[model samples]
Target chain A: MVKEQAHTVSSYEQELDQVRGMLVRMGGIVESQMAMAMAAIVDRDEDAAMEASERDPQVDELEREVETLSIRLLALRAPMAGDLREIVAAMKISGDLERIGDCAASIARRTLRLDAGDARLSPGGLRTMGRLVQENLRRAIDAMSQQDSERAVEVWQSDAAVDELYTAMFRELVTYMMEDPRTIRSCTHLLFIAKNLERIGDHATNIAERVYFAATGEQLPVVRPRGLPVV
Target chain B: MVKEQAHTVSSYEQELDQVRGMLVRMGGIVESQMAMAMAAIVDRDEDAAMEASERDPQVDELEREVETLSIRLLALRAPMAGDLREIVAAMKISGDLERIGDCAASIARRTLRLDAGDARLSPGGLRTMGRLVQENLRRAIDAMSQQDSERAVEVWQSDAAVDELYTAMFRELVTYMMEDPRTIRSCTHLLFIAKNLERIGDHATNIAERVYFAATGEQLPVVRPRGLPVV
Candidate 1:
């Protein structure tokens, strides 16, 4: 009887680990999606853009898998305390990661439209913003997989920088449109693309918060650092 | 023994009903947030914008309550099948509704910024778009509380219409910015506000999907209607 009880507990632990592994794997796919989207813009590679778009379905499929597994664990295992928090965090994090993929796909598609416009304008501060957001996403995913609350806090704090950079990009893009109305079509797409990247940063920070809460069993800080958005 | 079992089941049912009630209550707060946000734009009422912004904390508190109650249900009750699905959907729906509140607050904040600028351009088709979005939100909350899958499907189908209106507004706003450089500041804020409303419509549709799935143990249509996004 004791042996049977040991076997059941072991399997439950394995199931919990499996859920975490799936979330980490999903995060990796979403990271590549972000990388491909960024490459699409920096290199103006239409193939990269298409690749990023293609990755979206895969990310979404993984999210559903996480949802299914987490629900099954909830209904079957009846996790308690820390395990319960982690399982709940898995559901919320998967949702955020899925949104991050959507933002990547949206950015990638806009790049294709911008390429078709024949404007070929310089990206200016957009490159800086993209790199910062991409890095934040990486750190957030790292924090999740490593279960490092401190790293999650770091990622959460970096959102302010991304927001500030986005505001700067907004100003620069608007100036481009004002200087030459012919560039409005292209700059407009860039505006949304920049906004999409900023959104990705926000999602990453959301993931970071979930990670921190799940790992530490406490909320981050009362007052999150916020930047003055241009819009 | 049977008497005690009956009592336990009755209280568990009450817990499930409470989670659903919290979600519906949260939805009502979000709908008003959207309404006040629209009023801020239509009547240029700064106080309405402030009210919309203020309501966000209340909405958020309700969402956290839903989350706590749902998590407690999962950990304690270990709901099966339909009840489990409803609990999961409650958590997801509350997240969406909280985001809807965020979008409303963001829109309200931007209205203040728009008013700060001297350019008081006509709203064009934005008024129509806001009304449609508001109506959809109302329908979505009704579907949730009533467990009406058909109403949920209706809200899901209306997303394409909202998206189309948004694209039209995007073009109109760009024209205003192009025609008069002085209007760029105001129009840019308007652009983000329109996007925010479009997002509120999206959150409502997401809630609809959840409500439909929870009520009927089935996913919505695989191919969701999508519009050609201006970005």
Candidate 2:
């Protein structure tokens, strides 16, 4: 009976490891989607945007799979404490990653619209801001995959850089609108794109915080940069 | 043994009920805060904004309490299936509500930044958009409190109206900036306030969806309006 119980425990652990692997795979797709969306925007590549948009459903499918697997592990394995937290955290991190995919797809859609000349206004600072936010998201996922709380702490710390970029981006966009009437349409789309990237960054920070909680069982301080208000 | 088990089951039910009550209460405060923030914006009343900002900590404290109670219930009850979903939904819904409170506080801060001179800019559909979004949020909480999936569906249906109003408001604000450069800063703040309220509406919709899932074990369509890009 003891040997049987040990075998059952080993099987549960294997299931958990499989779920973790799926999460990492989903994270990779999400990261690629963001990068492709960025490229689509910067290069005004509609085909790339369409490809990113099409790939969103695949990410969605993976998210659903991860959720089902996590719940099954909970019900079947009855994992305790740390194991339970890991499963639950996996569920939440997948959720955040799924939303990140949504943001990337949304950015792709905006890129398509911009390419169609719905808005051609280019307010400065957005490309840099997008790059910064995308990097933060990528690092946050890496931190999760590595189970490195220290790397997660760095992601948490880097949230301020994203916010700083967003604030400066906002200021620049508003200034452009104030100065050039013709730039309003394009600038508005750019603003929405910037906002989407910033929200993606926020979700990444949320995942990092969850990682810290999963590792240490304590919530970390979520510090916003100076001058920007937390929403 | 049966009698002791009955007593323990009743105690668990009571605890669950208590947590649900606190969540409803927190939702109420957040809804009220959203309304008051809009009122402050429309009336340009700094005092109302200040009051909304101050009430945030109360909501935060309630959230912390709910989190503790939820974790305790999960540990003690080891609830399965529908019961577990309800508890988990409550935790997630409370989190979204807490974020709504934070957004309201953010709107209040933006209001505080706008001096008497800043209030001279034409708000241009912001008041109507704010009202629509706040109504959606209120109905969402009401649906959760009553466990009415039909009402939750209604809340989901109204998301398009909020989005429509947001689009109209965005267009009006852009037109204002085009007509007059002096309105840029005030209008930018107004834009932030509107965007925050719109996001709160989205979070409220998220909670309503969770409530629907908890009660019916089904995922519902997130019906966004047609003609708007799905950002």
Candidate 3:
């Protein structure tokens, strides 16, 4: 009986590991989607944009798989507080990751539209913003994999930089649109892409929070760093 | 023994009902927040904006309570297929609603910014967009309360209208800003508010999907209606 009980505990641990693995995998897909989407804009590659848009279904499928596995474990294992938090975090993080994929797809689609327009304006700080969000996303996923709250906190604190970069991009794009009505169509699309990237940064912070909560069994304080100050 | 079994079942049912009630309650708070935030923009009332921003903490508290209660039920009850879906749906819905509340608070902050600028542009279809989103949100909550998938489907289909309205408003605002550079600051804030409203519509659709999934064991068709087109 003791051996059987030990086997059961190990199975539960296996299930928990599976859920974590799925989340990290989903995060990887999201990161790739963002990178590809940004590449579409930077290189003006419509094919790359189309590829990024197509990749979203893969992210969505992974989210569904993660959710089903997490729910199955909840129903079957009846996890205690620590494992329970991790399972719940898996669900929440996958949801955020799915949204990030959507944002990437949106960016990709906007890039296609920008390419169709004749205004060949510089992307202006957008590449830098994309790099920052991508790094934050990577760190958040790394923290999740290692169960490192400190690493998660670092990713959480870095959202301000992404937001500041986004605000600057917003202003720059608006000026470009104002200077020449011809650029309005393409700049509007760029504006959406910038907003989407900002939102991806927010999602990274969200995943970091989930990691912190799962590891420490406590939510981080409500006082967080702010990038976009109220005007 | 039979009496004890009956009592346990009733208690589980009571817990399920409690989670649903909390979600609807949270939904109500979100709706009120959106309305007040829109009113702040419409009436140029900084007080209303501030009030909406302050109310967000209450929404956050309710979300925490709902999550705690749902997780406790999952751990203690180990619910089977139908009840498991409901519990999972409750968690997902609460997350979406909390985000909607955050979006409303963001709108409120942007409204305050707009008011401070003294440019005082006409809100320009923002009120109509607010009404559409509020109605969609109300229907989603009602569907959850009644377990009505048909109503959820209706809400799901209505998102396209919201997207079209948002696109129109985006163009109008851009034109206004281009016509007079002085209006740029206030118009930018309005643009954010409009985007926030569009996102709330998306959240309502997400909740509707959850309601449908909870009512039917099968997931909805992945080919769903979308409001914001790729472009």
Candidate 4:
């Protein structure tokens, strides 16, 4: 009887570790989706956008698999305290990643919408903003995968800088519209692009919060940092 | 030992029920905030906006309390599959509600921003569009609170209507700005207001999904119904 109990315990532990490993893989897919989406925006590459859209299904499938595995573990293992937090955090983090995938897909759709129009963005500023947002998203996933609270804090700190860029972009787009009525159609698409990047920033912050919860077993009060309009 | 086990079981069940009740109450508060925020937009009432902003803290407090209760339940009860779902669902639903609160406060902030200017929205059509979107938000919440799947379906159907209104509003605002550069500032604020309403509608749909999940332990695939722009 003692041997049987030990065998079952070890098997369950192995299964839990497998779930964690799968989550990290899913995170990588989501991070790649985001980066490709940004590249499609900066390069105006419809093929890249299409590829990102197509890859979204795989992300969706992984999310569903993660949820199923977590639920199965809960039923079979009856995890308690810290183990339970790990499972629950896995579930929530998968959700954040799935939404990140959706945001990427949304960006791809916008790229398609702008395909027939003349590009309206100033190459330098928009590309810089896109790169910054993607880097923040990548760091956020890395932080979560490594369970590094300090790295998560770094992601959190960078949010204000992203917001500042968004505001500047917003002002520039508005000025463009004002300067030439002809720019309206293309500028609207640019607005959508900026908004998508802002949302990616929001999702990155969400991952940071989950990391904090997983490590501390407590939700840090979500304080909207000083610089941006609290959305 | 048998009697002691029975007492503990009953108390644990009671505690779980209390947590559920609190979540429902929090949902009510969030729903009310959405309504008032929309009202402020239509009436242009700063006081209503201020009230909505103030109520945000209450939602925040409720979310924190729900988190604590959920963790405690996991630690103390070691609930089985069904009870575990209920607790986890409560946590997720509260999160959705907190986001709804944030959306409401966002609208309120825009309301305050609008008050500093006299930019009037095109009177008749824009008002009708605003009313339709607000009605959809209210019905969505009602369906969620009552667990009325039929009503939830109705809200889902109305989403296309809101999108149509948004497109029309977009065209009208763009025309107004093109016709007179003077209307630009006010039109920008109005644009933000419209976007905020659209987002509130999205949050309502999110809540409906949670309702579906809680009632049936299955994931609802997000189907983009036929009418809205894919972008």
Candidate 5:
């Protein structure tokens, strides 16, 4: 009977381990999608854009898988305390990761549109902003894997930097479009790509917030710092 | 013992009912926020925009409340099958509704920006698009309350119409910005507002999808029909 109980415990641990593995795989896919989308913009590579867009279905599949496993655990195991937090966090993080995938696909679609027009290179600020968001997302996922709420807080704080950079890029693009009306078409797409990247950063912060909440069983403040002012 | 069991069942029902009420309340707040945000743009009412933005904290608070309750119920009751779906659906729906609130706040901020410039009325198509999204969101919340998956599907199908309208509006605004550089700033704000409305419609569709999944115990196709090609 003792051996039987030990086996049950190990199997439960295995089930959770399966979910953790899937979450990491999903995060890796999203990271690649973001990279490919930005590369498509920076390099003007249509193939990269198509690949980024094509990868969304994989992300969606992983999100559904995570949801199924989390729900199964909730129903079957009736997890309490830390285990409950882990399963719920997995569910919420999967949803946020899926949104990041959609944002990447949105960026890829914009790159496709930019390809059809006169290629105005992404302003220098965009690449920098993209790198910031990418790093933040990477760290947030890492924090989730390690159950490190301190690292999650670090990722959350970094979002303000992304917002500041996005605002600067927004002003730069608006100025460019205003100066040369001919650039309006391409510039509009770039503005959207920038916004999508900023939103991806926001989703990363959201994941971090969930991780922190799961770890501490406390909610973060509803009002966060803002760098971009309207107008 | 039988009476105690009956009392326990009644308390469980009450707990679920409390969550249901909070979900609807959150949904109502989101709906009003969207309406006010659009009204701010249509009427150039800065006060309306500010009001809409201010309401977001309330929505955020309600989201936290719903999440806390849902997680507690999940850990304590181990609800199964349909009851489990209802709790999970409420949690997902609240998150989506909070996003819609954030999008509305985004639009409201843009309206404030538009007010700072030469007054430009929202293009004719924007109002039409706003109404369509509003109707879709309303129906989605109604479907959730009634557990009407068919109505949810109706809301899902209407998203394509919103997307088509958004593409037309996008092209129209881009042309306006190109024709006269003076319209660039104001038109950019309008563009963001339209995008926010389109996103609100997307959130409404997400709610519908969740409702359908909850009712049917089956996942929908990940690849949905999208009408707007960026080119």
Candidate 6:
């Protein structure tokens, strides 16, 4: 009986580990999608844009896989306490990752609309904001895979900078549009690209909170440490 | 043993029912938030905007409540098959409802920043989109409460109209900004407001899909019936 019980326990642990591995893999796909989307804008590479958009379906398929595995564990193992929290967190994290993919695809498609000849719109603010958001996303995914609550908290705190940069980008783009009416279309796309990056940052923060809560069994923070990321 | 098993089964059913009720309540709060947000933009009522934003915390609280109960159901009951689907779907639906609240609050906050004197921006397109979105949100909520897969499918189909109206609004606002540079800031706000409403519609579609899956034990349509809603 003891031997049988040990074997069952080992298999259960393996299943849990499988879920974690899936989440990490999904996170990696999203990270690459973000990189491609950013390159699409910064380099004006249409191929990168199309490639980023193409990866969205894979992210979505991964989300469904995570959902299925988590639900199977819930039904079969009846996980309690921290194990249960981790599974729930994995589910929510997958949702956030899917949204991040959506944001990347949205950004990529918007980049396609931007005029190639408009040397008028400076992507300086956008590039900075995108880089910061990318860093936060990376940290948040790492936190999830490592079960590192402290790293999750760190990612959560860094999101405020992304928000501030986004605000600055918003104002700068509005000024550009007001000054040159001809730049309105391209500038508006840039504004949304900035907003999409900010949203990606927000979703990353959400993943951090879920990761922290799963690792610690406590809510990360009631409100964002600084200015709330809003439209 | 049979009597005890029957008693346990009834209690499990009760718990599942409770989770469903909490989701319905959360859906109701989000619906009202959407209403207040639409009123804020259409009437330019700052008070309505504030009220809409204030209700966000309640939505967040309700989401936690649903999560707690569903997690409890999953861990304690070890529900199987249809019951398992119901609990998982409840958790996901609550997440979507929370996002809808977030979009509503976002629109309300942006409306707070709109210029009071710029009669230059027309809410006609927004008004149309908002109304369509509100109706769809209502139907989606109803579908969840009633467990009507047909109603859920209806909500799914109507989302295309919201997307279409949003595209039209996007073009109209971009044209407005290009024609009159002074309206650029307010029009940008209007653009986001339209986008937010469209996002809320997307969330409703998400909820509809979840509800359909829970009630019928199958995935909803893999792709939307119309244009993919991207920023």
The per-prediction tally of clashing pairs is 0, 1, 0, 0, 0, 0
Off by over 4 Å in 5: A115-120, B115-122, B229-231
Instruction: Show where candidate 6 strays beyond 4 Å.
Output: A1-3, B1-10, B228-231
Give DockQ: model 5.
0.65
Per-candidate interface DockQ score? 0.57, 0.44, 0.49, 0.46, 0.65, 0.76
Ranking by TM-score: 5, 6, 1, 3, 2, 4
- Overall lDDT per candidate, in order of appearance: 0.86, 0.79, 0.85, 0.75, 0.87, 0.89
Off by over 4 Å in 4: A115-120, B115-119, B122-158, B222-226
**Model 3 ranges with Cα > 4 A deviation:** A1-11, A115-124, B1-14, B115-124, B227-231
lDDT, candidate 6, A131-182, per-residue tens: 9999999999999989999999999998889888888889999988888788
* Per-residue accuracy of model 4 over B1-231 as CA lDDT, tens digit each: 999999999999899878877877887787778777767777777888888888998998998788778878877777766677667767777777787787778777776775344536664555676677668767766776566667767776677777777777777877877787666656665666676666666666766666666566776675635355635
Error of 3 at B218 (Å): 1.9
For B108-184, candidate 2 gives per-residue lDDT tens digits of 88887764776756554777778777888888988898888999888877777777677777777777776877777
Inter-residue clash pairs, candidate 4 = none
3 or 4, greater by DockQ = 3
- Please write out the lDDT profile of model 3 over residues B1-231, one tens digit for every residue: 999999999998999898888988898889889888888878877888888888888888888888889888987888888889888999999999999999999998887666465445756589888889999999998998898999999998998899999988988887877677667667777877888999999899999999998888767777677655735
The true-versus-predicted C-alpha distance at residue B130 of model 5, in Å, is 0.2
**In model 2, where do residues sit more than 4 Å from their true spots?**
A115-124, A222-231, B114-124, B222-227
Model 6's TM-score against the true structure: 0.96
Candidate 6 - chain A - TM: 0.97
- Cα lDDT tens digits, model 5, A50-135, are 99999999999999999998888778778898888888889889999999999999888887777355565554678899999999
Tens-digit per-residue lDDT, A71-99, candidate 4 = 77877787887788778788778877887
Local lDDT at A206 for model 4: 82
CAPRI docking class of candidate 4:
acceptable
- Measured with DockQ on alpha carbons, how good is candidate 2? 0.44
